[model samples]
Target: MKISRLEAGFNYAVLSLFTISALLPLVGVVLSALTPRAEATGGLAIPSSLAWSNFKAAWAEGHFTVYMRSSVIVTVAVVALTVALASAAGYGFARLDFPGSTPLFFLLLIGLMLPAEAFIIPLYYNLRGMGLTNTYWGLIAPQVAQSLAFGTFWMRNNFKQFPTSIIEAARLDGASEWRLMWQVALPALRPAVLTMCLLLGMWTWNEFLIPLVMVTDESLRTAPLGMAFFQGRRSTDYALLAAGGMIVAAPVVIAYAFAQKHFVRGMLGGASR
Candidate 1:
């Protein structure tokens, strides 16, 4: 059951190599962001002085304030809706029996295989017709639908793994189905819910194609789409580009850093169940 010293050393070496490979680009980006515009020749090098001004310049030029607000609003809305709807659907499929539950779950699973590209054209027209396009709902609605399939599947498995005795006790105490779902079941599935929310939030935040297609107004452009525009305009300005990139990526990184414990637990729990 124990790994030999040589094998352990080999594994450590392999992991270290992968770690460094992953970190090297990030290191280059951070260094580039700090370098002066003139000095950043698109090559990674320690700058003579850290130029915090690059971020300021990028912020103003990219209109990141507006873009970040859009992204946050869309992300939060999608995540909130996805988590709420998915948890309910998941618990129903896992615990409540219905005539078509199996078929319905399979139908939902079909969504996971559907590429956004397939339905984007119809979706855009549909949203436009509904007067949702160029608004936050235009951005939020599709992502919630896209994320729900996986979220439902994730929560269903986790809910299925919950202790039966606990639910029975709650039922004995006259807990209504709504009370059981909100108070007992959901609280017990916090880690799984949190994990799904984080994943969904990241997806919604980073979504480019949907927002790009749905919103023509610059104000509605999410961070990623705005970053793309900034990158195109400032392709030669590596420092500003790097700064913009960092600004766009920082939120998801910060969120993950804070909630990684729950994220890991949720993934493990879902996998085990």
Candidate 2:
């Protein structure tokens, strides 16, 4: 379908407006990061000096290395566990017929409906009892539980879309259940897996409330939690804050940039019907 010249122009204008609106803060934050402490953008004028040192200071002050390490630990653990458990759950739900399986699956879906805030009090008590609070396992356990709901839902849908014929053929060839899942089915679910990892990574990395509520030890804080602490220390230091914001954002942005194609495809592509 060929759009008219006027229509195309109007669409382009609308696109430009939306794009700018979305990115305006990002632009401001980047520019603000580069601006000097002495020169306030009182107006959005070109900065007389670029304070690239703000990035370095934010790093040292925020103890970014520690936070980054903690964040990576939590994110990697969460993604690995979620994919494994959810994949198993998805496959069972899709391919197996057991008593009350349907109802059990819906119980998992109920997780998607309830807000995380609703479970915080009870979850905290559980973690506290386990003596996991302020520890990596403490942070990881809650994330895994919260994630299982959506992860299982996503993988169930993904599994439902897979061809049953392949699974049957694998079984005919004497492939064990584990082998079939690991060697055959899992490979085909690459796009969905990638999408889930990217999504989960971003979510866990940016998570603030969970860390805030669970972690009291300064050393155990993730980047976002640490960023909040950094923000409080330098309340008037806008440039440093912006620089720190950019630091916290950079890794996830880079991950998405590399996975953009798979991410987009997985969002729209269903299992082959």
Candidate 3:
């Protein structure tokens, strides 16, 4: 079957419209970041002379080096732990039959529906009691738990759609369960795993409430939280604000640029499955 020319044209037009809509604000922000502070009316005006120094100013004054370091540590830890733990649990739920499996999986799904806001207060008290507050663990542990919920769900769906024939063949060839999972199924599901990593990376990097509630140390602030403070101090300076915002956003954008192919494949394949 083929789309008619009129329909194809209409689809393209709609996509183009949506693309422009998405890009317009980003364009405005980029232009604003580049414009001199005095001339930054914040309405998408092209700068006569680029204010590249705004980024340098924001970086030093906002203490972004410290913030970015903390962000990287937390994000990396969350993604690594979530991916490893979630993949194992997802495989167990999807492939192995056990007592209480259905109910247990449902309980895990509860994490997906509940927002951090619902338990943040009690969570803070709990972490404080454990003496984990204002530490890197304070930031990392909760995020791992949150990311795991979604990561497990994502990987389980992918695993469930895996070919049973391959598993059977591997079993007959004396492949242990561990070997089969680590060597065979996981490799085949690279795209899905990568997609999970990218999604979790973005979420962890942008997480504000968890860090805000968990840590008081200025050094422990993540990029987004740091940007909030930066914004407060430079509220009147649009150029600096935009530059700071871009600095915080750059890592996720760079990650996506590198992993976009795998991300797209995983999404489309998961949908199809």
TM-score for each model: 0.97, 0.95, 0.96
Candidate 1 lDDT, tens digit per residue, 1-273?
999999999999999999999999999999999999989987879999999999999999999999999998999899999998998998899989889999999999999999999999999999999999999989988999999999899988888898888889999999987788889888877888889888998888888999989998999999999999999999899999999999999999999999999999887874332
lDDT of 3: 0.92
What is candidate 3's lDDT per residue for 85-120, written digit by digit as tens? 999999899998999999999999999999999999
Lowest lDDT block of 10, candidate 3: 264-273
> Model 2, 183: alpha-carbon shift in Å?
0.8
lDDT tens readout by residue for model 2, 66-170: 999999999999999988999999888988889999999998899889887998988899889989998999899889988999999998888888898988998
Model 1 weakest lDDT span, ten residues long: 264-273
List clashing residue pairs in candidate 2: none
Candidate 2 — what's its lDDT? 0.88
Name the runs in model 2 displaced over 4 angstroms. Answer: 41-43, 270-273
Which of candidates 1 and 3 is the stronger one according to TM-score?
Answer: 1
242 Cα displacement, candidate 3 (Å): 0.4
Candidates arranged by lDDT, highest first:
3, 1, 2
1 or 3, greater by lDDT:
3
Q: How far out, in Å, is residue 259 in model 3?
A: 0.6
Ranking of all predicted structures according to TM-score, beginning with the best and ending with the worst: 1, 3, 2
- For model 1, the superposed segments whose C-alpha errors exceed 4 Å read 270-273
List the global CA lDDT of all models: 0.92, 0.88, 0.92
- Between candidates 1 and 2, the one scoring higher on TM-score is 1
RMSD of each: 1.5, 1.6, 1.7
